[model samples]
Target: MLGATGLLGSKIYDRLHRNGHEVLPASRATGVDAYSGQGVAAALTGADVVVDALDMKTMSRRRATDFFTTCAKNITATAAEVGVGRLVCVSIYGADDPDAGRAYGYYAAKAAQERIYASAQVPATVVLSTQWFELIEDVVRRASLGPVTLLPAMRMAPLSADAAAAAVADVAMNPHSGPTVVVRGAEEADTLDLARVILQERGSIAGRRPRVLRQLPYLGRAIAGGALLPQEADTVVPGGIRDWVRAAH
Candidate 1:
């Protein structure tokens, strides 16, 4: 697995490993940088398939675009050189829409990566997934200022890392007929509500629920509304929100 070390990537590696697949965890820490060709050739030399789960911190728009485009170029070139058969990439939901109002840079990078992989000689699958349940706590942890936690007013079907890994693994092991697939959680959730749950569970707030405020971009309400819950189809998973929170805990 190319990413093999991030929260999702680590889960993918563990799932694939438990399923008895010979796995390779490629990353800068492992001496294989996907952004550079340094050790990629050797890492991918005998691998049958590759899965990409690399991530950048915070999903900054400009940085994410550059990171993904560059990473895709590097991975594709090296995978081709090493004769890898298939590539599976984990992407964010709504990445294909040029106008999806996702504020994170990672979304644009994912879209660019999709285009690059689509044009590659090797077969590829891009599995676009909804938000991960872990993100609820993450956003709260990061966005919480004083006693309040600000959140984007958006819809999300937050999947577990394991479920997402299973989806990606299925794509990696199977034929790539659908170059793109959407994988969603079992239940839809509000970002603020999810944050509230986390905050309550973690004992971050007491008494009344901390204010649930909508976060707006300086651009305008259009960017905030459109970039965030742009409509999309449901990507089904078996477990529900409670299950995801339990697993995460």
Candidate 2:
């Protein structure tokens, strides 16, 4: 596990460990840096499976591209050197589609990472997942300006981080031979609706009325509509927006 302390990676680590699998959780805290190639080889030694759940905080195109490409190159090369057979990568849905999310630097970098995996010496499986329920807070924060919030008129299907982590663990342990697989939530929703739900939940938490004008605007340069929705054939995880909101309360 490359990012064992992350939001999704920690859950993956716990699930894999609970299943009686010996997992070496690697992260910055564990002194493993994929960019500098520090402490990666020792972590890979005697390990058969390599799960790349690494994440970056920046959205800069050049920086993100460099970070992902360098990390992928270093990790894959080291894995191949140590005789690691299976490489599982966690990625976003629609990353393979060049037309989708072209305006976003993060998505573009993700696409580049997928290309690296496709051409890697060791066989790789990419687990494509939708947005997580935990992202609602960040979305609300980014969309907010004073007492008003502008949401995108876009559709999204979001799953819990736990569900996504479970899927990753299953794929890593069972070893999916396919190049890519998708996992998503049980229901589809618009961005405005999600924002409303989150605001209402927060209001209830604080015991004060929520005051915010909600408006729908085009999300980004590229996200028009249905770009974030999962395919019909994609694996849908259990639970929906209402369930998640209720649980959050």
Candidate 3:
């Protein structure tokens, strides 16, 4: 299991371990750097399945593109050399769509990563998931200014991190040979509505209302209307934004 210390990766590692699977959790902290191929071979020795949950930190176009492309190249090469059976990658819901947030460096990099996996020698399964409920706070913070928050008027169906992890684990263990599989939350909502719920939750927590005006705009160049929304054929998880927020608060 690569990136075993991350939010979703940790859940996958725990689930695999609890199910009596012999899983090796590898990451930068464990001296397995996928970007440089350092310690990757030793980690993959005697391993049959590899779940790649690796994530990049940068959003710069050049840096983000290099980070994912390099990591994918190194990881796939090493996994193929080791004769790994299946390579499961966790990507975003709209990564395959050329018109979905293409201007965003992160989205473009993700699309490149998917392309890398699709052509890899080892059989690969790309599990695309929607935004996570855990990211609401960060999105709110980034969209906020002095006294106003400008959110994108885009539509999305977000799942909890746990739900995403569960879906990833199922794909990793089952070993499916397919083009791609998308997972999303049970309900669809606009970004503004989700932001409102987040603000309300925070206000209830602090016992005081936050004085902030909400507005909408086309945040990403390629995001408009329901462009980021998953298709009807995609798998829908059980929890929605409201259920996740209520349980969290």
Candidate 4:
């Protein structure tokens, strides 16, 4: 697992290890730079399949593009150079969309990375999963100012990070001869509605009354109008907001 420390990467590394697969956790934490080829070869020395879960979490266009683009090029080159057979990557649901938000520059960066893999001779599969439940929490936190909270009225089918990670492991174990398999959550809920549920649950313990402001006019309309919806379906992971919260609690 390339990004063995992230939300998904940690879960993936654990799942693979617990399932009896000796999974190696690769990252800059281990002095292995997936983007710079510093320790990539050494880290991937004995690995048969590589799961790239490195996340470039930033709002800057240039930073995001640089991260994933460089990651894609270096990972593909090094994996092929090391003679690794299959590569599995965790990408966003709408990463291929060119009109996604500037905040979604990471998605565009991921897409650019996919382009490198697509052209590479190494067999690779990009698993595009929907936003996780924690993303809902992030949206609420970002929009919150004291008691008032605003969220994108947009729709989301938030998947479980653990399930997404498991799916990545499954794909890695069974190397596929395809371009990419897009996975979304079970059901679609309005962003505000989902936020309300999460806030209400967390609010019980956190002692905060978060008011939801949905789709206020102006730029809010653009945010509310399906800016983050998955257009295709391949594999839908199980679990919902309630399930996630229950587990977290």
Candidate 5:
């Protein structure tokens, strides 16, 4: 498991363990930096499969693109070299849809990451998911400016990170799940509204609270349009913002 210390990664590690698979987690904290090509080879020396739950949490285009592409290259190349049979990557929905946030750098970066795995010699499974309901706080933290919060005027089926993790673990444990799988939330929602709920429930984030919230559709047409919503979901996670917030606190 790559990025084993991350929020979603930790959940995935748990699920994989519950599924009775011996999991060895790899991340920067575990001395396995996929981007730097350090300790990755040794980590997968005898591993049969690798699940990359690695996440680059940033709104910056260049940073996100660089991080994903570099890390994907290193992981795929090294996995192929070490004779790993399968690679399971965790990504977002609409990563391959050009109209779905192509102008958004992070979307483009994720698309590039998917392509890297697709072209690899090792067989790979790409698990695409809608944004996790748990991520609203992180999004709020990044988008907040002083006493106000500005977010994308986007639509999301707010999936729970826990459910998404289960989907990844399922694909990791099975060989016939296919090359791609889409996991979505139970309900379609607005990002602006999700942010509002986050602030109202949490009161403040990172020691600061935003009294005002706004949403803009400037990031990309896909963000505002229905391009990012899942059309066919192999895994429809059961939860919404309200449920997430209730368990969040």
Candidate 6:
């Protein structure tokens, strides 16, 4: 498991480790930096399947593209050299679809990342997942001004990190899924409403200075048009925002 210490990565690591799998959790903390290509091949020396839950904390087009593209090259080259069979990578829903809003900065970088991974030697099982309920807090923190919260007016079916991690870990261990797959939540919701549910549940908005929520077309029209939602055949993990907060908090 690469990037095995981050928000989603840690959940994947714990799930696999707790289930009696010999998961080689790799990250900067363990001296395995995928971005730098240091100690990456060594970690995959005897591994059969590699799960890439790597992430870059940037929304800039140039920086994100550079980071993901470099990481993909380094990871794929190393994995192919070490004879790793499959790479189970985490990705966002509609990353490969032009209509799903790749015009956005980060989404465009993700599409670039997907292109490199798709052309690599090792067969990759791209787990295209929807936004996670866990991301609500991060969005709120970044989009908030003094007393106003600016949100993207996107329609999403957000699942829990645990649910998405479970699916990723399953693919890593089983390696029986298709080249690409979709994972999502039980129902669709407006980003504004999702934020409200989380904020209210956490008591973040109750005692705060008078606050307001506003929606902006941060990702253009595709997001609000439901282009990023789950496909009809996709199997959604059960639970919604409230379910996640109750279980996690």
Top TM-score hit: 6
lDDT of 3 by residue, 19-124 (tens): 7899999987889999999999999877878988988776586888898889899988998998888899999877656766465668888889999999999899
lDDT of 5 by residue, 1-249 (tens): 798888989999999998889999887777898989999999987788899888886767789889999999999999989999899999988867776636687888898899998898999999998988777777777788788888877887878888888889999999886889999998898888887676677776545677777888877777788777987889888777878888867
Provide the lDDT at 247 for model 6. 83
Cα lDDT of candidate 1 equals 0.72
**How much is the lDDT of residue 33 in candidate 5?**
89
Local accuracy by lDDT, each model: 0.72, 0.80, 0.79, 0.74, 0.84, 0.82
RMSD of each: 3.2, 2.3, 2.2, 2.6, 2.0, 1.9
Best lDDT goes to which candidate? 5
Better of 1 and 2 by TM-score: 2
Report backbone clashes per prediction: 6, 0, 0, 0, 0, 0
RMSD of 3: 2.2
Candidate 1 structure, TM-score to reference = 0.85
The TM-score of candidate 6 is 0.93
Candidate with better TM-score, 1 vs 6: 6
Model 1 residue 1 distance off true place after TM-score fit, in angstroms: 1.5
lDDT of 4 by residue, 37-144 (tens): 899889877678888898866767689888888888888888888888888888876667665543356666777877877787678888878788777666656667
Off by over 4 Å in 5: 200-209
Q: Model 2, range 22-114, lDDT digits (tens) per residue?
A: 999987778889999999898887887999998887758799889999999999999999988799999988655555546567878988998
lDDT of 6 at 16: 90
Candidate 4's error at 195, in angstroms?
0.8
All candidates: TM-score = 0.85, 0.91, 0.92, 0.88, 0.91, 0.93
